[model samples]
Target: MINTILPKPFLFLLLILICAETRAVPVPPAAVAYTADIIIYGGTSAAVTAAVRAAKDGKQVIIVSPDRHLGGLSSGGLGFTDTGNKEVIGGLSREFYHRVYMHYQQQDAWMWQKKEEYGNKGQGTPAMDGKERTMWIFEPHVAEQIMEDFIKENKITVYRKEWLNRKNGVVMKKGRILSIRTMSGKIYTGKMFIDATYEGDLMAAARVSYHIGREASAVYGEEWNGIQTGVFQHGHHFKKEVDPYKIPGNPASGLLADISAEKPGINGSGDNKLQAYCFRMCLTNHPDNRIAFPKPDGYDPLNYELLARVFQSGWNELFDKFDDIPNRKTDTNNHGPFSTDYIGMNYDYPEASYAQRKKMIKAHEDYQKGLYYFMITDPRVPANLQNRLKTWGLSKDEFKDNGNWPHQLYIREARRMVSDYVMTENEVLGKKEVPKPIGMGSYSLDSHNTQRYVTDKGFVQNEGDIGVKAPVPYSIGYGAIVPKKSECKNLLVPVCLSSSHIAYGSARMEPVFMILGESAAAAAVLAIDDQVAVQDVSYEKLEQVLLKENQKLRFGK
Candidate 1:
């Protein structure tokens, strides 16, 4: 008989080891303190612009950022700027892209490839122009440097790596944020506050009302607010019929790893599901500045079986949208079915604790990195495709600290505040006019795939990816950014504003976020000056300041 019992001493040692493992915990960061007229949370481009605007108005503004770098997605590998109508981009947002144009004007900026060879392609225009004086697309490092310059020039004080203490950080007084404490034990007191974080951490801590996932169409009286299936406008769906089961056409064999066997809800019904998230990879073919995609710790080829099936079906649009940025680099985004979207991976991210969120982020990183490794090495992929993919590698220059990966995940949409004025599809589509115009949004109503499921006919399919173009550039209301007066009177949320799922899908562009950031700062300054709540700030007075600052509140058709 096999010996199964352990010695008494050995069992005691094992119990002790288990206790030590469970008892070990991360120590809280050392304490620090600050006082400012306005405190902005998050290190996004919006956070920087808001701080600058507040400082320009003579308020003592401070930025408490969780990230070490600035400009969130703009500086983070999403180098291909997504401004649908460049004509509507104005103020600091325009200034940012113009600076990108000037950065390329210098010959030394072209490190990996000659500027002439890189050529004129930026959101369908010359990236490096002297006369028209604007560049919509740029390299990641260039954008980060410019944002840092903005902070230095304005003398804005920023404390990096300081996360808001969600449990008991926000101190409320008379329906307003009196102060907030961070995980680092730093206390900040501000008259007016802005939650510029993508997750709306500060806003949630302040007890503000917010929505986490897609709302049913009936709630908003909109056509495109809920789960979308059998609609493949973006061409990311499967091109051919492929079985979702582990063994082709065999229910006994069960479902594939990526394909969910669960029934996707009624087409227009609601569910607690957020859109997919992926790292916008900055990849290059230059031999000197390329690092091969690494095989992560939990590399499972079985996880990517669906992709192998896709290749078997002869779908070859994988490289068609590896968008070129600068040098010989490309911003590798989700292009085809079973690609980088990582469908059904981020449903809990919006509300997950920091620790849980880290696990989700790591899972996404491993999946994406292993995917590239699989493409280059897996035998199931066609030889021609493997040959083409092997030429590209992660850009060594960008995201140098984090294994050449994008520092920020593309958090397309998250916790949106349900304030007094909720931006619905009608306002976004120009069918209903906003009562108070603070900024403009021009991108399409775009939401990435939320779930991958099996069709009744036994084929793999994706749901919740929609790309409906806006009728025209539409205004974003001021009330959308401000919390309901009854909930919290002094908090402003530019990144996670009051909007329906479909409406936020359009307004969540980086340029629009910067515009709203500036506008939110202007309102904060006004509120502080008048000693009133942010919701009580007059729109007429705020518009005067915005117009003076060259904000394009009204956009042309």
Candidate 2:
């Protein structure tokens, strides 16, 4: 009772005492310890390339990967490579394809098909001197062997299954990174660091800014950056008035599926979403080397009813894009409507943590597997179409660990860093110029579907897929890989460089990543030698190193 009647000054004093006690507790020190000339975090093509280049340059390098495997999608069932202009590929990137050729030299390498039957047309790059180099298309295990060989040859230190610390453990002294700790309590201190991950995890943890979703086409003055509702290419669009709801177009009947009933965003404006992601499945029609597609658990027929309708609409060009690899296996990809892409379903994946990412991967696996099972086994499926699809199955020689399911899903694009320079469609189309070239990319600007929405004619149609060719190979700016000097001084991001969604489509290829990786490593080495921030490294010096390394900075005549 006496305390309740206390004066205002006394109460204020007690509050201050409590606040002081709370502030007196000290924060715990970061755990773990490691030291290297360069520490690269990721198992992507860029990560591997960076580690190899650094080691070859006589610098101590360590690759900390959360994956058990070495190569990213290159060894992860995406065997049919997405090579734009092969001439731009040099250094470690070219070395990878050469190894693939070496593997195919053995007669036993053609276990499933004869060597001559497979031919050499799509195997590797056509050399500028009119001779053929190693074929780019390869088996998953073959690519893995090549990566393992690179590691052995370089003797690079690798820490597999180690994830970077995204919390307070990325200790920085001044603007440079002092060290980075992982979730397993392992710390790595390096003079220079490359965040080669597709997600830009390490860069984000170091307080570097990044972007997660697609910006509006107008944001970067891009023509193909945002939602494209009416543009349908390759017959992937819905031809019928399929209801977005579970009750089949009756709004009063309530939502039918897991899709949000909210209004689909404006066609050209920005949205907090991304394009679909799926496994570039390595499949085979060979009987002995194929495992008949397994019916996934919790099989849902309703989930694939749209696909059946798509088939019945005479959109049966199912095998149009099964790009062939060696050994009679195919790096199958999205084709007609209701194909493999799980549209508008992977928005949360880029920024998700490890545990959450695994869950998302599993969910995608179930959905895709169930979709295949439904197509083959469901009574509603046309008998002719079912018979045709029955011949296809997962390749036995690939992804054996998870019942022939690929280990990695293709994350087409994610977490592009907002750096000093953002590459736009204008640059790719040759309508604009970018100085300070570090690397080059020439692929067609490609973006898969971002959403499946109803059209004005009341039919479901695929939207946001774009394929626009560039006038020529364009030089990528070095500033795109480095943040402004005020952001972070010592960090380099190769995989997720600064670019709009439309521009990233061309740059996101694996070969380009390898090119950027080498450039980033070269920049890191130069920075270390000059004892200057990465931003301060002269473009002239960087250009010399890139040229010496055989990296193509400009298109050859």
Candidate 3:
């Protein structure tokens, strides 16, 4: 009662503090200007290749990248390339691997161990051979150096840490994009543009049509495009009954675990979600070159309870698929039921903004780092399993700037452009022929599980994962790179090429991206020569250029 009234002096002081806190700081935006004949707007492998090719073609080209680092995941610890058929790789993509071969020729490249001690066989692709036309498998820094060499040798103008404006800032006149603005208030002008980003942000901002999440099988007459619940192939599903409810078998007791209690969608139908994403962590066993995994802040043991259950289910085969690279380091990835992929958690990331995407990437990092920390240190983990995991640590030479973390997160899929020619499963399965070949993809139609849910028998399981090999290397159409002529005329999209989900699963490989990049550049140059939009580039002329560049359009005998 006595303290009900506030003192006049205290009130005045509080008001003054509030005013000071609310005051805004005035700072002028930085001004930047650039002009080029061709402008590439991503920092991926494809972006680098396209910019270099354009520069090599004697076009004044510039690369504006939001990333501080180049080469995306190619240099960001995915040293074990995901190339399907090495024979199909040519031009800049093959050149990248040759540089890796050159880097390892010297004894000094083996910083941790002897060259012979390191296994040449890596994940998804074959090892490097000096005389062979194709090369794959390399170290992280080696790839980065190769890309830098490409840029330096070509003298391509590059602007790092620049992002494009997503609003009404892409200036266009007479069906050609004149210039584009960035959030930092910088403008870039060019005759032709390539939206090489995984997310297709530039294409979207330019009023081009794009898609997010997987489409239903029915939408494109695709057999494997939608929700697939009963098909579990990778040994991740539960074999025995386990309750999904909080109380053992009672539905009224509420749902258990981290899953949203929402109804699991019907099988083979569309859903507004994408597969989970994870970092491809590079680990080393060399004591001097390894950084021990640190316990993350806000660490929760419950987040990894599923992994413990996976372990308890008599699945002791841990060191089965680790692809060993140089320096006694392994490019560790998803194995068994609960591995590196934090399933069902990265649905909204494909369309999210930079700030929101950052938060999602950080969360994935925390989850994966915590998973490792918990496995090695947690008392619940089997002693045998702990001993094996304890031998591994983050590679000292890789991602040195960011606490030994891989620079790129695996963006499995993103906004695909709904262009004139959409690649489908029929083409990949060799049921139908694809005309106007620009590139080829030979990897399996692989899509990781989109969700983990409880089954009817009250057992937890993973769903939406599919892995089926393509019948043969299928030709990627030139029309897939451009939007319908009515939508956009001057844009070329390499990363988010038009394709069905199943077909994209195969076409989504990095080498394929580089191949497509080269083709896109050739088309852009041809378009400029003919004085026509990208959509108007003649297929016969484009095919001739691709063949001359040594691109494998059709599968060879």
lDDT of every predicted structure (CA atoms):
0.90, 0.81, 0.81
Q: Which regions of candidate 2 are displaced past 4 Å? A: 1-32, 119-130, 239-249, 254-260
lDDT of 1: 0.90
Q: How close is candidate 1 to the true structure, as a TM-score?
A: 0.94
- lDDT of model 2, residue 91: 74
- Tens-digit per-residue lDDT, 425-444, candidate 2: 99998888888888899888
lDDT, model 2, position 300: 75
Positional deviation of 315 in candidate 2, in angstroms? 1.6
**For model 2, what is the error of residue 419's alpha carbon versus the real structure, in angstroms, after optimal superposition?**
0.9
lDDT of 1 by residue, 98-126 (tens): 88988988989889888888756766456
Clashing pairs in 2: 123-135, 123-136, 124-134, 124-135, 124-136, 236-337, 246-256
When summed lDDT is taken over every stretch of 10 residues in candidate 2, the lowest stretch is 123-132
